[model samples]
Target: MTSGPASSPITDELLVGALELERTDRGVLPHRLPAWARAQCFGGQAEGAQLAMAEAQPAGVRLALRTAATTVELDVVRTRKLYRGVPPRPDGVYDLLIDGKLAAQATATGGDAIHIDMSTGESHVERGPAATLTFTDLPAGEKDVELWLPHNEQAELVDLRADAPVAPVPRTGRRVWLHHGSSISQGSNAASASATWPAVAAASADVDLLNLGYSGAMMLDPFVARIFRDTPADALSLEIGINIVNGDTMRTRTFTPAVHGFLDTIREGHPTTPLSVVSPLYCPIHEDTPGPGTFDVEALREGRIRFTATGDPAEAKAGRLTLTVIRDALRRIVEQRSTHDPNLFYVDGLDLYGPADHDELPLPDALHPDDESHRRIGQRFAQRAFTA
Candidate 1:
């Protein structure tokens, strides 16, 4: 973490947002979930590496600097996961915003790659050459510049360098909007950090954002709700259903109370803040069928990875929750609450992506939306839900 002769180490003031940086032997790992939530995530068990990997991918973290430098360089050690038979996902994008507008994008050409056997779920790491992302030819005057981290990769920052010294940018004084959801919100297939649906909506709504979209996690957990209860947020939104269905973790009897409890906890701290409850997007596979979603064995046999619901739609009546069941429950819950709590609202996930969208956009994995769908969902969410 070097710096100019007169300045402190640039890494010391790297402007990490919504991430708690923990130093590691490699460098620094950015964790979205705080220490307490992390403890709860582990629950006195061993700190699970797989869960650690997921939370360490800094989906909304960035380095914002107000500086006058013609050239800037960032040293990053990225640990990328490679699944067998699946082409590698794109490198995490570094979106550079100068004066509040995207001016450039780049990716580190070298990093460590960990290959995982799909069948065995075992991983092996191969060390790779070092690479530095360099940005040059910047305008001279002091300007707000943000380097958005890749939403998909595990990036460890070793150093930051600039031709001139850098200073942290002041906040924009926008209201802070906190959001939570599943992989779709965590940015499953999104191309970049700034392009993630939540980031896009936050930009449109002009809010400082804290994204708690942990992939395969948003289980309507009490700890998550407690996190919201304590965070300083001017508004809140939760995208529910998909994860509940996929994990098959609970029946409707338990889910109803969980949703109510989740909301009650948030209301403890943010009694009057506008809160929006979003149902799941239209997913054909899970709309009627119950889940316990599993890998598509047939597709995997054909060398393609996909997901399928193992639970029958008939099981929904037996208390197993389907997307359809969850949506209806959420609508009813929000409707009942909104009569007395006028600030509460419900946005049908169908409005963001519905039967029409599922038809046209067709989730390729039968789970997550593609980049184009992400753009459309983000745009629609901004227009429909995000507002002062």
Candidate 2:
């Protein structure tokens, strides 16, 4: 199916990304979750706003090719959602990597955007259809190039073309870092595709990245554990806590066993893989207060969207989950497990984003970090967790 344009001399290569593609009339959608997990969504067993968001954003996915093409273009359908009170998100950016180094970047504009009224919980399409992204000029050689799709929006790969014939780049055989987490790790509000913290950290650590950061879907799902068990990985990290707090998913009692079960499943395949259990980043909204975060009503009325903690602070005593509560529990769990597991480790997420850093780079929407913060986080994580 990928056979270039009628007038072009070079061939087209659309099957460059990791996931299998599902074609629609307009374009092709990428799938990170495997068939079983997707079946959960399709069969109405896990239909919710969370899965809707997770499956859309190509958080850690990218397209790779080894070619001498001077110019490359991708026909893209960018799906952007605008919360009623929030500013319209910037156009999705495509980051290019050449020879395993950041080479160039571009944005996909004038694509289909969806305006969603968060207050009303309703959505409608904004006319602007799909657009083509073209990166031109010359770097004439058989260099390996990877195009990272935007991490924040839904992008349909309409088409891909280059000035020369292209083929899938051979794997570098570098250690694959498999990471799972919530929206922060999912690159929520991240500046661009390759700039997400995990992407940055992975590049800095010189590891092949397999990002499983499913927006709001990082709630210790057994199916995701299955993915971890089956997928090949050299190292693993679980950014735990934030989603549990904000989603108010479970209390300490339930959370403890869930963590054990999740880890046990992954260890089934990666018995000795270096597994790092990460605690939550510092967030004032849920530092001591339990969550079930809600939007700030007054801010929403003023054409702005911000999150506020709703759960009571005292609820922590009753085993309600909070950032502090979850962190402590996670540490204890890792400590206990490490007694029998030599490769297991723990990295405090606060070490990457603590109170001091929070004062310097606060979460913009009272939830997700902005671009500068993402850079700080990626840098700190690389320095702290991946040190020799």
Candidate 3:
């Protein structure tokens, strides 16, 4: 949805900008998060630019911000300046206005102090959103506040105002979610991101999203995990498979254990958080295949490849890796973990992205999904996976 200034009594706008102080091209910029940094899936940094701007603003001024919910955090740095009030209490909530409209209000509280080294030195503080702050009163005097953020090569400002808050509605905690995935759940180019089974399911159910998909990167690394862990989400979903099969990240002996370990790490803090684990979508590449992945660098570089060269049914029988293997792993995980963690659930990834989607939305790269596919997948995730 388009977010900017609101229409009503408040006319003044607070202008905030951010610029990088160092020479690195990867620092955070005002209003915009670093692309590479986002790719890393690290928390705290997502909204570093926006929070930096908020910190610099004077107390009692309303602020509007535009970005993903996961980007907000509280960590002070000399490089990042605050207007007044000796840094906000870790538990304090800051009103977040996006172009005169309130997008989300957040606060971070109750955590062991961690020291962050900026241009200054080590400082102890808690980071991450502790809770969502709600404002019932508005500050008097200046109707708005502007924040300037500087990082690396760019600088920009964001304006906020208390006079005009987005039209307030009853406190219904409804939320729309955006999600992304890889071939494992894309049905290997599952129809489209918007309709990638997940999108279809989400749409049939109703949801929202901004899907960023890369077919090869669904390895349960810290990056992808951070994306889900940090984002303000009511429900989250993950389809695991394909990459492990196609790239052959591990052996069958190691695959099951790896999956278990990955889930364990995520549940570290999100104990009661709702989660859905999806097995592989349908793909003929490893219908019954198993073992290590075959490599052909020359063909890969030429951008021409096939799932496997042997096409040997014997490989399937030998227990390499297949959809069944993934499904079994997921079931085992749910059965064992569900006793203690009631919120954890499982889904068949193929339900969203499957062979049928292939015919409807052909795979452009035979591996990674195209933009259209990303949308389809995102929409589906919002619907099926996100629904409580």
Candidate 4:
């Protein structure tokens, strides 16, 4: 009989798509934003909590290694969010890929839980035991393997075990595509981490991905522009407008200049990079109406959560931003800037998920896309942005 699997400590060198790792009492917590960016959250109580949760979810993170082991095991402590009246969100999925193809998928058992009061904005956490996820009966010889962590869960890696020793996979020198957007790009409603639209697009385009998609937090902050200016990327894109309209964050006066400033900062570093400015996807509720989106309390009473825009359509004429207004402004801005910025590109977000597709694959909550929509968007984005 073969000997028991050998244990290995998880390390930074084996991780991909995470900017930093924090050591916790139980294990290492992967962070998409570096320490400097996380540090800025302090004192901004309103946006801080949302940003904290979004960045810690590790939407595109995974562990890459080469091993001959036919069996593998990973120990993790996962923290999931739960709303008081709503159903608990499902546990995040871990996807195992061998030789660049999806091989298997699994979810961790018992772990910590966080319950949040949506109405009061209060939260409490309860500690629980760690979980071990195992994968067995792999193909015999050594092969490159990747264990993609949950895109929507906060996971702390405790330990790793394999039937044979594991080593880091050598970098493949692939072109790096750095993308920034809101929850849609962060894998909201996607089936798994590897299935996030950006992840799927990167795979199809044969490029490495750096996803800076923060749920509810892509408001064109100066710090985020600085992050873009600093990071090295072969290609860059920004999925703007949705979060801006969702939050009703900026008006035309402020948004127009902010977009210019944001692009200028990125160009400071990536002067000639192929940069694409992506507008918001087709969101029916906010397509024509201005928003400060609100929850459907009636639906909440029925144990279903839904969102509805509270702002009036007339507000758009008064300079309040809606998806339509934002899209128009974005298109004009891209056209005006393209005269001097030859490398800049504009991608109409509606083309990714427009009204026609919405009728067939309507967003369950009236905001985020479902699994199938994510697949189509990713595939379409690959064709539009990468192929062209």
Candidate 5:
């Protein structure tokens, strides 16, 4: 790498110098390699690029990131065999470090999740990798920084930077966003952790994200709200509806009280933070439907599959919950809470994944969205909810 003044942001120029396989007493120069890099005979994976700034300096270096994008750049050799099995899903854990301290971390997974048709012999690059974790407001002082990769897989390092770190833009004071949701928020099938919607929202809005999206277990629990209460946040979002509906976790009477209790617990600590209660997006299966259970016996007998009984059309309309119910519940909650705290907010889940999007971007499994859907959701959020 180009060793210059020690106090510069590690930039693309510096990365170019360190591209070769250099021998060092501490093993090899490129320690980790992604599968694609290995096939190309490039033995080292570019974990990531980082910038170190002085924490105690007079002019404290503020890193203002307009975007945290992750793209896969590779030169695949025809002779190499692409690894099989479900490609890793993105999970935001790839961290950016400054002075041995974590400045920011992004998580991503390789393979098909990023819409890469690896089955065909085509070079793929998934843009806008997700941000899993981020540490901001570094104290101005010189610090050595590095990228901490989540997995040891190999890939070449390309555009990395630190010198001339982008300065933070002036705005209202930072907002801590604490969110709780389901698999979609948990990163699902995204390429890496940073590509997830929550991560995307956090980076775009310039805020902290404490994601509590349980993959298969999003039961509206008092414990979960307790967790939210303990964490410090300036704003909070509860993406409810879908998980409860999909899991068929509770009855209408139970659902109402559970939601109320959950919010009550969160308010114990964050009584004044701007809170937004969101319902489920537009889902035909559960839009006006209710659930107790349903199953596809034909598919099951063929050893193909099974289904849940909760989504029957008539039953859903009768005793089960619908997006409308959630909307009403949220409206009531906000109305009641607004009487005491006027900062409460409500967003319809349909706003995120409405009926219009369904026509163009159908959920691959009739449940979770495809990669395209994820991108659309993130973009919509950036446009509407995140602008504030």
Candidate 6:
């Protein structure tokens, strides 16, 4: 292999979609949540640790520059989470885009690993060396380049080397759309970084994206609301309900006001911005069942991963939340709020992925959507929220 040219220092100007950059002993880590928000998470704290892990995945984050280089190399220290007994998770994918189109893809090998005991909720990390990812044979002219980081794993961008000097991409004046949601929005089972529904929607809608989708952690936290409140955006959207319901964190009495408070915080910063409050998609498992969703131990022992709701269906009568209950409440909230705040709107998640669509493109894990479903949802969301 031909040795690439001198290394270029990765700077803040070259990154997009990340809210903060953390300098680590090995490299710089991209964070979707600002440092202040991350400060609230503690490794020893269950919910706090989950938020920290989710935010570090860098869902919509990418390095963008203009270069004439025919070869590009990026060194990274990647850390992936694995279950002790369940099937291993796939390696995170890195997508390289040239002039707005996907040109190539790569994955770093032998970086680091986190082994978790599902039953005990304990985890430990195994250290590994950094890996170099190289892409060769570009079109041989100055072009805009985007290196989208993995949306499912933690990656520390160690260094960059290229055949030619690179400069930051000039601003395109695209409207920025900041969104927050659950795992589906975090690209759960999506094929690549840009394939995540939110990323796809932003691209199709021709807007810049700032994705703050934390898997299993979208509980309308005050810190999260504060992040949205402080961030700048032309438009905003929230994919709420699934994480709340499945986590079984709150009932209607608490959830309704929490939604109001979340929106209230955001509106403090962006009073008139177009904000869409989206409810959960059609999840049959949680449609009428209250959760505290649990791992399917049988499936896990068989080396398959699956989730099943554990809450009683009868609990719905006592204001316990289900997908159906959440959706109805969200609709009413939007209707009531829209009278005074016209920019605030509601998009039923069913419109994006309902029963009819589910019949054809079922969620692979009975939770997260498959790649095709993500595409469909992205297309529908772009049309409903952007074009409309």
Candidate 5, superposed: residue stretches over 4 Å from native: 1-174, 292-310
Weakest lDDT window of 10 consecutive positions for candidate 4? 38-47
Ranking by TM-score: 6, 4, 1, 2, 5, 3
The residue ranges of model 2 lying beyond 4 angstroms of the native Cα positions read 1-17, 45-47, 115-128
lDDT of each: 0.82, 0.81, 0.44, 0.90, 0.51, 0.91
Worst 10 residues of 6 by lDDT: 38-47
How many angstroms is residue 259 displaced in model 5 relative to the true structure, after the best TM-score fit? 1.3
Error of 1 at 20 (Å): 1.3
lDDT string for model 1 (1-388, tens) is 3234232253535655554778777666777877777877787553345455667788878888887876788888888988887757777888898876888899887789999897787879998765788888888777878888888887888777787778887665768888999889978878788888988888887777778887777788787898899888888899998988988988999998999999999999999999999999988889888888988888877867689999888888899999889999999999988988999999899999898888888898899998888888888887877643
lDDT-wise, the better of 3 and 6 is 6
Pairs with steric clashes in candidate 1: none
Candidate 5 per-residue C-alpha lDDT over 243-343 given as tens digits, one digit per residue, 9 for 90 to 100? 67766677677887887888889889988887777777776666666653334456445543233436666665455776567777767877887788776
lDDT of 6 by residue, 1-388 (tens): 3346769999998999999999999989999887767777654667687778899998999999898988989999999888878887678999999988999999999989999997798989999999999999988888999999999999999998899989998766879999999999999989999899998999899898999999999989898888888888989999999998889999989999999999999999999999999999998899999999978889888878788999999999998999999999999999999999999989999999999998999877889999999999999999999997
Error of 5 at 70 (Å): 17
- Expressed as tens digits, the lDDT of each residue in 355-385 for candidate 4 is 9999999999999999999999999999999
Model 1: CA > 4 A from native: 1-13, 43-50, 301-303
Q: Rank the models by lDDT, top first.
A: 6, 4, 1, 2, 5, 3
Best by TM-score: 6
